[model samples]
Target: MREISLDRLRTLVVIADLGSFAQAARQLNLAPPTISLHVAELEARVGAPLLTRTRGQVRATAVGQTLLERARRLLADAEQALEEVRGQVAGLTGRVRLGASTGAIAHLLPSALATLQRDHPGIDVQVQVLTSQASLAALRDGRLDVGLVALPQTASKGVKLMPWRRDPILAYVPADWQPPARLTPTWLAARALILNDSGTQLSRVTAEWFAAAGLYPQARIELNYNDAIKSLVAAGYGATLLPQEGEGPELDRRIVCRALRPGLWRSLGIACREGDGDRATGHVLAALKHLRQ
Candidate 1:
């Protein structure tokens, strides 16, 4: 049997992931025919078809799916080995893919990334804003090197989890409205409520908080961005519950930030692949860990 080619294996993985030969070619910077040839070569070597192409997408067969999984591991291992060598000889140099929530990206991540960039300028950090659930899913799919997500997450096998930070969930209400000093769920629920997107973890937690108080808040509107929620709240649309994020602009003078009764909190933490102990990823994780306060 002919030897399996690593480049072809990587090509197969990218093709399977993107689901388009043209897309895979563009991603790999190869010609479209080259992508097809790579798959053909792999099929010939394994004596089985690896990909079935359709009108707009491509999918792997059973044998191809198994091989694609193995190929990802192999490629990850090879890349780790190269990164290790670079770290030993020069310094940590590689890209670390990270996933975070909008709040984390706005408030928590900048400080850590600032220090990481100052220290290891060689390491490249790619960040995407995703909800905790989405981040966890990406981590399980091996798309993210590290995830700063809301806590109480169930780790997929081979994921290393650590506690990071706890943030108080605060309410934003119209500044002119004198919300009761003790903000009870029932009191808040009696008012028009605005909440995070309906399906987000934050929204779920918010719902639980209301439910625990024997009341429920049916939001007049749900939004994912904090600023937009604040804007809507300031316009007297309704009150909202959000992590206390203060960045781009001053809290709308018309909006009052208040802590909830019973002190609702959200937990966030770092998660990495268990065996990923690569120096580059570790350096980045350590940088984030240092900022855990």
Candidate 2:
């Protein structure tokens, strides 16, 4: 059996993520040839081409994807082993950059981070609020140690997405606008709405749902920030859709939040680079799961 070097495995993971040796090399700070040599060495040992390259983009072969999964587990276990040893001697200390959407940032992340901090005081954590796609992209590019994103990401090629939780997508109406007994397409179309920006998954889903129901809302304004939407709705500017749990005190007092009648909900969860088989990701995931439970 050929011994697998962690360095080679890391190289393969990086290439699988960035889809180009040059990009991976730049990320790893290695010469492109050096990175290529590492991948070639692994391919030689595995006896299969790990990457299928055409033009400038690269993708993992079936065998490569399978190996990538195992490699991620192996790498994570390896890092955990090292962390365990280090902790036994001194302590675990490192920074982890995590990304989340506005909804998660408002509802889920603070408690999760507080719990993690209680357990691992030495570890520093930073959180970035972004759209689900942006969060997934950051995770793949190795910028984030982990992220919480809505499901059905367009570029989830090398990611391990798991269900985090489901939250209701509520319709927010201004105080003056008399809302219907039920929020239906016909009823909602009569009112002006402040829709989420086109970039977010929420915006796409909302548009799809409305389109499917043959409802075109009266246009008022467009905004990316959910908080802004809530604020505008409160001030009687327009109605909007937001997560059920995302109702702030001020918004909750002023607006009526009700579940969308046609059963629209967002499935969200934690994700990380498959290569991040590290103690940090595992511990954080476990903590998150515990919180959800």
Candidate 3:
């Protein structure tokens, strides 16, 4: 019986990433022959060829692809575990990977992360802007430690859901249009609509808001960014539905923000792996809760 080496696994990963054994050798600060020996060792242990060299390039073999995937997770887990142990010895210090929606990143996290950093100076926070659907997938896959997503999101048995805050949905029209103080569904639907991604939670709720009034607003444009949508609407291209929070204080000069007639709101919540023992995650989660108060 033979044991696989972590160093070999790491070199394999680096080779796959850099696309050449020579490049990987440089990155690992090892000689090319050493790199070849490492890969040869792994192939011998697994009874398979791990890579194939093409014209001036190197690519992973089928077995290599599978091993690479597992190796990455293993490496990440190993690194994270070491960080946790180190954190316990020193002041709290580890990386917390946070997945958040655009709105949450824009409006919510700046203050929360500021507080987290201030309270736990040693902890490093990394945030990625993701849609609710994407955030949920990442959370389940262990890529993200915590996700800030819309409520009523798909619940998986492996995660814990915590309600965060509700952001009101608002209507944006051309600044000079003189919109009514309170916008109506019928009136909103009649205008040319610029909405969020068709697959997003915001879009689904916007659809419901329209269906409730028995009107289907034809979108003049569909986009993922509020800033882009605002600029387009402000240019008198169309109207849009955007969450009230995270919107910049001064909108594009041409757009005016108004409250929706029925006062619609979308709830945001945090999702983390069930029974996660990471102290850094706990600290950031607590910071979010405190900021919300």
Q: Cα miss at 191, model 3 (Å)?
A: 1.0
Query: Residue 263 deviation, candidate 2, in Å?
Result: 1.9
* Model 2 steric clash pairs: 76-277
* C-alpha RMSD of each candidate structure in angstroms: 15.0, 18.1, 13.2
TM-score winner between candidates 1 and 2: 1
Ranking by TM-score: 3, 1, 2
For 1-293, candidate 2 gives per-residue lDDT tens digits of 76999989999999998999999999999999999899889889989998998887999999899999999999999999898668633435556788887767777777777888898776667888877888788877878878888777655667777777777787999766767656876677777888887777787888878899887564578787778788888888878887765334555567876667797887777787776466766667767787562
At residue 34, candidate 1 shows an lDDT of 91
Per-residue error for 69 in candidate 2, Å, reads 50
Order the candidates by lDDT, highest first — what do you get? 3, 1, 2
Per-prediction TM-score, please? Answer: 0.68, 0.65, 0.70
Give the clashing pairs for model 1: none
Clashing pairs in model 3, backbone N/Cα/C closer than 3 A: none
* Candidate 2 RMSD to the real structure: 18.1
Candidate 1 lDDT at 33 equals 88
Please list the residue runs of candidate 2 whose C-alpha ends up more than 4 Å from where it truly belongs after superposition.
1-91, 246-252
Q: Pick the candidate with the highest lDDT.
A: 3
Q: Per-residue lDDT tens digits of candidate 3, residues 1-293?
A: 87778899999999999999999999999999999999999999999999999897899999999999999999999998897789855648878899886767887788888898788998888989888888889888989988888788768978888888787888999978889998999988777889997988889999999999898777888998777788899789889888877445677677888999898998888889999457888898899887552
Clashes of each: 0, 1, 0
